[model samples]
Target: MTALAGLLVLVSLAALLWQRQHTLLTYFQQEEYDNTRFFTAWQNVRLFDLRATATIVVALVVIAAGAPFVGVKLALAAALAGIMLIERRYRFKKPLAMTERAKRLLYLSFALTLVLALLTVVHPLWAIVALQLAPVTLVLANMALKPLQTRVNEGYTDQAKAKLARLDPVRIGITGSFGKTTVKHMLAEILEASGSVFYSPGSINTVLGHTRHIRQRLQWSHKYFIAEMGAYGIGSIKRLCDFIHPTYGIVTAIGDAHTERFGSIEAIAQAKSELAEEACLAGGTVVVNIDVMQYEPFQRLKKIYDLRMITVGAEGSDVVVDAQETDGASWRISLHSKLGLIPDVTYDLPLLGAHNVTNSALAVTLSLVIDPEIADQIPYFTKTIAQVPHRLQVLDTPGSALILDDAYNSNEQGFMSAVASMDKLAKKRGGRRILVTPGIAELGLEHDRVHARLGEFCSDRCDTVYVINPSRIPSFAETIDADKVTVVEVPSFAAARAAIAKDLKQKDVVLYENDLPDLLEEKRLL
Candidate 1:
């Protein structure tokens, strides 16, 4: 029995570690901020702390039922209760959206573990492995159930469908690795002048997200619907396209966003372009960024299929935004037509980076068909965009210091834009710029190397740098003065807050670039 207890303890420790990773994974789902916030593994354990307490009761009941050292089991239950109390007292994070479900599942799993532990007295080896995997399996089971549960709420979506049906709206489906979210936002903004529509929150690309948006917020009067569909491999976007059956498809630039699963950029492009294929079958227009080399085949796909491909680029674009560095004008904003006629219209777009010009251009042209009045809203859209709530939001604080919160830049181009945004602010303010980031992750070797170059870019311009995670050691090496850059080891969020509070002083331009989100939520590399 003592030997079994010892083995159980080891298995529990491993389970604790595994749960931490799982917890971090949950927080990472909404990881849109950099140094301002972070997801810690400890929070995972804490959120599921209730399971630990319930497990003791369950264990006690089972052991008592089995008549195996009743007093010891009772004492063990009491000890477990006390330990859980202490654990709850020490835990330091807010309850996440998945907390309630996790608690229920954890309790059930611990009960199972107790049953298995009893079996371990006879079958030791299998029990140990079972104990470690119980909580994980519970989580997986819960995950499997959520989609089914969400689908049952199909009546709400039917109302949305009815409303959209009344409006006779032309729906557009946008999908890609990096720019899909931005593109969706852009499309909504550009199309608002034509008729009423919703942007569907930040990265509302999932099936549930779309379903909820359509079910709840969709109005009968709206003329257009823009849905951003995201996928990991083949058939994923096809599933989404099948659901909405978009009239127009927008394929943003594709890269090695999910190379680990997709195998290569080619595979990623192939997976993403399915939306275009479906849109063509639906007799809908397919708008693609021809500037993207992967879109070269899309240009060809335009000729063969029903796909009406609208291409945008810096040199020759239907709608373009040319830039001049008044203080910081990195992204050019212009308007044109396919016939190569400049519309002599301009927008002071709040969004930075030259790449957004293409994004905005593509959005503007595609939207005009559904929204001819969009031309009037361009200037208003530019002002209201407000940096997409952490994507290059520049704030001028007291004491002559400026803070550009580009917390959502976890992609290759996004990282570059952050560097440029920081430099722009630095040049304007004439103060030292400070970059605080964990750098981007899961971008495969190409993106990792790209981040290293970003480190070099920061080194050239910024005066001080702070990296939240030690995983960016290669980035630190690329720095101008490796010693000058501070590397903070982050195991949890509290430690990160303390470190940032200590380093941040007045009179400095700070750019919190990106924080890598854990997988299971996105096909985007991070």
Candidate 2:
């Protein structure tokens, strides 16, 4: 019975480690590790349900009372076997592979659990309780490995910096609350006309991710390297700049995208402005959207840096988007800049959303800064740009229905822009406008207010709205006029898809705004 309990404890610890690998790493990576966040996340999953908690508690009590160990051993073994079975059933749905540091932490956790399980011969309760304390073990293990991880990361970053210096590419740093990726891709496409260009792929905006990209992908043949810098607080972007040493920078737009983490809009701006500050300090030009200039910090940045600042927007800017007309998934815009390089320029943008036009304007401004001759050929280069996936990407269904897949990263501005674009497309097709979303997140204190506003905006534009997690937005029902629009609450995306298949017609337009991962959902663990 003792040996069997030991085996079960080992298996249970393995299962728990596999399931919580991502969560553990996320907590470890936090600026200040949050135990509350860790516990809250663990409690939301079935593997750490109340039954598991109670089993460990009972096992601890049994050992403390010096009762016959057979009953507690069998109970723990059975409970652990059940959790392993449950975890195995859903193992195929696992998320991304754990990082190297996370794998190291898991190995440490396994070693510690084994040490505790050895005590099962004397007291089986020790092993059982250790299984339940896997999270605490993970925390301790992470704390021990942090210093070593930092050293390894610094070594890798140094290697990347050495590689970057040898390649000698003209780096352009891009940062914002949102639209950074879009601008990065757009600029890459436009700048390709000038020479070979490379960009950090996907949302790999972290320090390690950027280091990996520079070390692995950055080639000597690439003339322009675009780095999308992301930050949760001040000095984050500066760290990336120190390594890459970008010659130019662009601040797309500042908003409440990461206000939750930074705690205030000013703090968020300060963090984002680090990119511009570093670029200017290197004697490089910085492009900013005029829309964010109303903020005081940006004004201060302009005064302090006294850098070559190019502002792009519809009004009050050096590079102006004169007029924009959207036709389906494409845009035709007239752009005129005070810089004279791009004069009364008319271009076709193969993208969606009005915000995209501004993003392209920034790209255009940067391209002109790089090579002024490209201005005359802006129309030719614009055609080479394509719509980025999941950022208002238009797809066609089997029944000729239009599916607007904007389900990637969600923020207030991006969500509203997609809704407006969807409404326009639906009007043109004379189709029923359907919206499927779980609503936005990460607004922190403003989560409810932002979601409420999104709900109100959908009430007017959508013919039928399928809210995946209606409870996520507590103020949703109050903001919407149910009498005017049909609102369907779904428990999951599967149910929403079923409803769409049953009701959608050929001319229907379905806008999938934002889909949250199951980890963020609120539910009973069992």
Best by lDDT: 2
Taking the tens digit of each residue's C-alpha lDDT, what string does model 1 give over 199-252? 588877866568778777777677778888888568889878767879887877
TM-score of 1: 0.76
Worst 10 residues of 1 by lDDT: 517-526
Stretches of candidate 2 off by over 4 Å are 1-40, 43-49, 54-79, 91-94, 122-124, 304-307, 339-344, 522-526
- Per-residue lDDT of model 2, residues 251-339, tens digit only: 99988776777888888888887877788778888999888787776787788764377677866577778645766677787767665
Error of 2 at 428 (Å): 2.6
TM-score of each: 0.76, 0.89
What lDDT is reached at residue 516 by model 2?
Answer: 70
Q: Residue 183, candidate 2: how far off, in angstroms?
A: 0.8
